[model samples]
Target: MSNIQKIGNPARQSNNLLFKRRSILKTLSLAALLPVGLGAYPSGIVIAADGVPLPENVMTPDAALKRLLDGNKRYVSGKISVRDFNVNRAILAKGQNPYACILSCADSRVAPELCFDESRGDLFVTRLAGNYASLDILASLEYGTAVLKAPLIMVLGHTDCGAIKAGMKADKENVDFPGHIQTITSELKSAVKEGVKLPGNATDNVAKENVRLNVAKLKESTPILRQLVADKKLMVVGGLYHLDTGKVELLT
Candidate 1:
C-alpha cells in the first residue's frame, strides 16, 4: 500500500473516534433528561450520591437477609451470578449502596464477597482477624447502616480460623504470640474459654462463639445500630463459613 492509503486510514479512524464521542455525549444528555430512576434504575429508590441508586432488593431487613443467603446458596452450588464490572464501574465511582454490612475475618482464605457471590457495590465489608466488633468496625458499620442505608449486618466467622486457633493455643500453652498478633489472641480469649465448655469441635465452637458475641454487640451497640435493630429496619446475624464446601451456615 502507498503512503496515501496509510494516511487515509488514520483520518477515517479519527472521524470514527469523534463520532463515538458525540454518541456518548448525546446518550449522557438524554440520561439527564429522564426522570431519576427511570431507565436502568427503578423508581422510589434514592441515591446516596449523584447518579448512584440504592439497591431495590433491600427494601426490608428480611429481604436483605434472604438475598444474602440466596447468594450464598448459589456460591455453594457453583452457580454464582455473572458480574459485569465494567457496567457498574461508572456508577460505583459516585457512591455505593451496599445492601449489607459484613464484619468478616481477615484471613486470606475467606473473602466475604466471593463467599456471598456478590460483586462490587453489593456488600460493605470490614475485617479483623477475629471478626470482633472493634470500635472502629462498629463506626464503619454504623455509617453503612445510618448513612448508606444498608439493611443488614452480618458477623461472619470461618472454620479453622487462625486467630481463634491461636487464641486456643495461647490458653493451653499460656504463651504470648509475637508482636500485634497477641492483640488478636487477647480479643478472642473470652470466646475460647466459652468454646472449651461447649460440645463438638473446639475450634469451630470458638469461632461460632466469637461470631455470636460480635452479633450481640452490634445489636446492642448504642444509638445507630441498636436503634435500627429495634425499629426492625436492620437485622444483625451471625454465620460460619465452611472452608471446604464453600457453604455459609447461618449461626443461631
Candidate 2:
C-alpha cells in the first residue's frame, strides 16, 4: 500500500461520502473505552482510524519511540532507508500525520531528520538555538499533539553546543551575549547551574540538562499536552545527538 493509504484516510471521504459516515458511526459504537495512563492508547480507539493516518502500533508512544531509535540504528550503521520522495509528494501535500515531533537545535551539524532517518512527513520538527522549549515552541508542540496527533516528542541536544557554552560562560564570568543571542543563554542558565554540579564535561553536561529540562516542561505543560500524557496518548523524551559519531544517545 502507498503511504497515503496505509491508514484509513479522511480526505478520501468525498468519494464514499455516506458510506464513510456510516462506517464512522459503526466504529464509534466500539470506541467507548478511554485510553489508559502514559504510553498507551485504548485498544478500542484504534478501531476508528479515520482522520488519524498513523497505524495502530504507531499510535502508541512507546512504539513511536522505538521506530525512531530503530531508524537511528540504521543511520548509525550507514544503511538508512532509500526513500522514494516522488511517490509520497502528492499524498503528503494533502495533509501530514507525523508519528513523532522533535524539538532540536538549530545547529548545522545536528539535523534531526538525518539523525533519526525520518523522511518528509514522518516528523514534525521545531528548532531553536538551545533546543529549549520556549512558550512559542511549547505552543507549536501542543499543536503537534492536540491537533496533529503526533504520539511522541523528543528534545534533542548535542555535544559541544555553542548555546550551552555561552550560557556557562555567562553564568561564570557574568558576561553578556550580544543582541537576542542573550535570550538563548538566559533560557539555558538554570541547566548550566544544575549541570555544573555534576563533575565532568560541564558544557556537554549542560546541553544534556537543557534537553532534560525541556522534556520535563513538555510533559508538565498544561491543558492539552499534560492531559494527553496523563491519559497515555502522548510521551515526551530527551536525546543528545553526537556530532562526531552520527548517533543519538537517549538521555535519562
Candidate 3:
C-alpha cells in the first residue's frame, strides 16, 4: 500500500482509488445530465466523499477557476484523501497528463498539491523562489500546455512569501546572495514595487501582486500561451493562498 508500490504495480488498483475515480466520473456525468435547477436534488450536488468533481473541460478561464476553487475548498476543509501513493506512482509510470500547470514559489509552506488538494499526476508544477518567469520556466510551461495539453496554467502566491520579503528589503547595505538567490531577489523587485502601493501588510500585498504579475507576464511574454489564449485553447489564472485560513482566492 506504499506510494511506490501502488505506482509500480499497474495491475493492482486499490479499492479506494477505483471507487474515487468512479465517483468522480459519475459526479461529472450527473452534473452534466442535471441542468442548473431542474433535478430532484438540484440546489447543488456534492460528489461522493465530499470531493468536488473537476469541470468536464478546463479550456476556458472560468472553467479553470471553478476547478481550482473546488479543489481548494476540499483542501481547506480537510477532505483530501486521494494520495494513495502506490496507485499514483503506477498511474504516473505511464505518463502525466496533468490538468493544469502551476507556477509557484519555492516557499516551504506553499506546497501546491496540499494547497489545491491535488494528488500525483494531477498538476504540472514549476517552482522558483519568486514564481518569476524565466526562460527555462517558460519552456517547461510550453511543454505542459503544448505537449501535455494541460488546459490551465496558474501562478500561485501565498501570504508571508519569503522571496517577496527579501526583495522588499533588498536595499539593506550588507545584502548578499551566494548563488542564484540574487537573481530571485532581482526578479521580485517589480513585485515589491507593486506591493508598496497596496494598503495592507507589505508581505501579503506583494504576494498577491506577485501572483498577478507573474500570470500577466506569462500571458504576455510567451507566444505559445498567447496563441492558446487567442484561440481559446487554454486558460491562465492568478491566485493567492492564505496560510492561516488555508484558503485560495482567485485574483482574476
Candidate 4:
C-alpha cells in the first residue's frame, strides 16, 4: 500500500471514533453542567448554553486531510455549504492546533488550504517563491513540528512553477536581486541545473526535484525533526499538486 493510504486510512477510522466519543461526551457534560433554563440536554446535538455552536476540534493530520478532501469533493461537486463565519471565527479565537505544516510555493494558483480544501487554522503553511528551504524556513518548520507538535510536514510542489522557470534562465553574470529574492533563486539554481539534465520539462523536473530536496533537507537539517522521524512521531512527505487537474500526487 502507498504511504498516503497507510497514513490516511487508520487515522480516518480513529478520527471517526474519536469524534463520535467526543460528541457524545460533550453533550452529556454540557447537559449536566448547565442549568435547566439554559435547555442544554443530551440529545446528540451540540448547542452551547450561550446559544453558540461548539467548535469542532480536528487534531490529527489524517483527520485534517480527510476533512480537506471532503471539502474538495464538495467544492468540485458544487455542494459547498455556506461557512458559519461567526461560529468558526469564535472557535478559532481560543487557539489553534494545526495538524500539518505545508512548505509550498508562493504561486497564486497553489494555495495549500484551498487546494487541500482546509479551513483557516487547519494548516501551518510556509510559502516561498520556489518552496526552497532556508534557515528561517527550517526554523519555522521546526517550530511547527517541535513546538506546535504537528504530526506531518508536507513539502508541496506543483507543475510549471515560475520560480523554477526563473532559476533555469539564471546565469552567473545576471544573478541579481533587490533583497532576499536572490537568495531564493540562488538556492533553486542547483535544482534547476540538475533538472535540465533530466529528461523532462525544466518546470516539471525542477518541481519534483525541489520537493525531494526539501524533504531531505528537512530531515537532515533539524535534529528535532530527525528525532521525531527516528521515534516515528512524525512523517515528512513530498507531493506534487497538478494545478490543471486539481489533483495531489504523493511522490513515493
Candidate of highest lDDT:
1
Order the numbered candidates by lDDT, best leading.
1, 2, 3, 4
Which window of 10 residues has the lowest lDDT sum in candidate 1? 10-19
The better candidate by TM-score, 2 or 4, is 2
lDDT of 1 by residue, 62-161 (tens): 8888888999999999999888788868666656778999999999988999988988888999998889886568668877876666889999999999
lDDT of 3 by residue, 19-43 (tens): 3444446435643554332112233
Worst 10 residues of 2 by lDDT: 10-19
Model 2 C-alpha lDDT per residue in residues 60-106, reported as the tens digit of each score = 89999999999899999999989888866755555567889999999
Evaluate model 2: give its TM-score. 0.78
Q: Give candidate 3's TM-score.
A: 0.73
lDDT of 3 at 211: 83
Clashing pairs in 4: none
- C-alpha root-mean-square deviation, each candidate: 17.6, 13.2, 15.3, 14.1
- Please tell me which model should have the higher lDDT, number 2 or number 4: 2
TM-scores for all predictions: 0.79, 0.78, 0.73, 0.69
Cα misplacement distance, residue 195 of candidate 1 (Å): 0.7
Model 1 root mean square deviation, Cα atoms: 17.6
What is the Cα-based TM-score of model 4? 0.69
Q: Model 3, residue 140: displacement in angstroms?
A: 0.7
**Residue 246 lDDT, candidate 4, scale 0-100:** 74
- Scored by lDDT, model 3 comes in at 0.70
Per-residue error for 102 in candidate 3, Å, reads 0.5
Residue 61 of candidate 3: its Cα lDDT? 52
